[model samples]
Target: MSRERKREGALYLCNQRQRGEEGKASGKEDEREGETRTD
Candidate 1:
């Protein structure tokens, strides 16, 4: 593989990992919010 493509692939992977973490955090927050509203 070319150097640039390899670099881009690494960046893409990093972004995907970050997005996954963010999604998990948001999901937790949503569950908390839902509970508060129901109370």
Candidate 2:
């Protein structure tokens, strides 16, 4: 369940970044892993 755990972690980070207006980095990180956290 490593991937699932990573996804959850990424989502948490992404939300934090979105709040700080730095979501671009988070989105790129997710995209590189074939996932996305679009707003």
Candidate 3:
């Protein structure tokens, strides 16, 4: 049971990190688009 719980925790942390990276990437893309629109 403990091992399974540890695995689950690791997976959750991995997912959270991936989500954060994706959010940052999308935010940068949005900024680029906004700049292009203004020009």
Candidate 4:
């Protein structure tokens, strides 16, 4: 509702999104490793 609160909320959302992206990247790396093992 307040401007400061809005800024904090945005920061929190951005941090959460960054974490999700990192998780996805790590998962992809693991899949690549599995493929390499198969090859």
Candidate 5:
């Protein structure tokens, strides 16, 4: 039971990290678009 719980925790952490990276990527894309628009 403990091992299963640990696995779930690890999976959750990985998912959160991936989500954070995706958010950062989208934010960078938005910045690029804004810069191009201003130019």
Candidate 6:
């Protein structure tokens, strides 16, 4: 992936972590976001 997508993905990880939620559900959500981002 390009630097921008990596940066944005990192930002999303940080944002999700900041929300104080973790584990399987968030993982699935992140995957969905990544798919959406690709679209």
- Please write out the lDDT profile of model 1 over residues 1-39, one tens digit for every residue: 699999999999999999878878777876788899999
How many pairs collide in each candidate, listed in order? 0, 0, 0, 0, 0, 0
After superposing candidate 4 on the true structure, give the runs of residues whose Cα lies further than 4 Å from its correct spot: 28-39
**Could you tell me which residue pairs clash in candidate 5?**
none
Q: Write model 5 residue lDDT over 1-39, tens digit each, in one string.
A: 999999999999999999878878777876788899999
lDDT of 2 by residue, 1-39 (tens): 999999999999988878657646456665666553343
Question: Candidate 3, residues 1-39: lDDT per residue as tens digits?
Answer: 999999999999999999878878777876788899999
- Model 1 scores a TM of 0.64
Q: After superposition, how far is residue 19 of candidate 5 from its true place, in Å?
A: 0.2
lDDT value for candidate 3?
Answer: 0.90
Candidate 3 vs candidate 4: which has greater TM-score? 3
1-39, model 6: which lDDT tens digit per residue? Answer: 699999999999899787756545467877788899999
Return the candidate ranking by TM-score, descending. 3, 5, 1, 4, 6, 2
lDDT per residue, candidate 4, 1-39, as tens digits?
699999999999999999878878777876788899999
TM-score of each: 0.64, 0.46, 0.66, 0.61, 0.65, 0.47
Better of 2 and 3 by lDDT: 3
- Relative to the true structure, candidate 5 has a C-alpha RMSD (angstroms) of 7.2
Q: How far is candidate 6 from the true structure (C-alpha RMSD, Å)?
A: 9.2
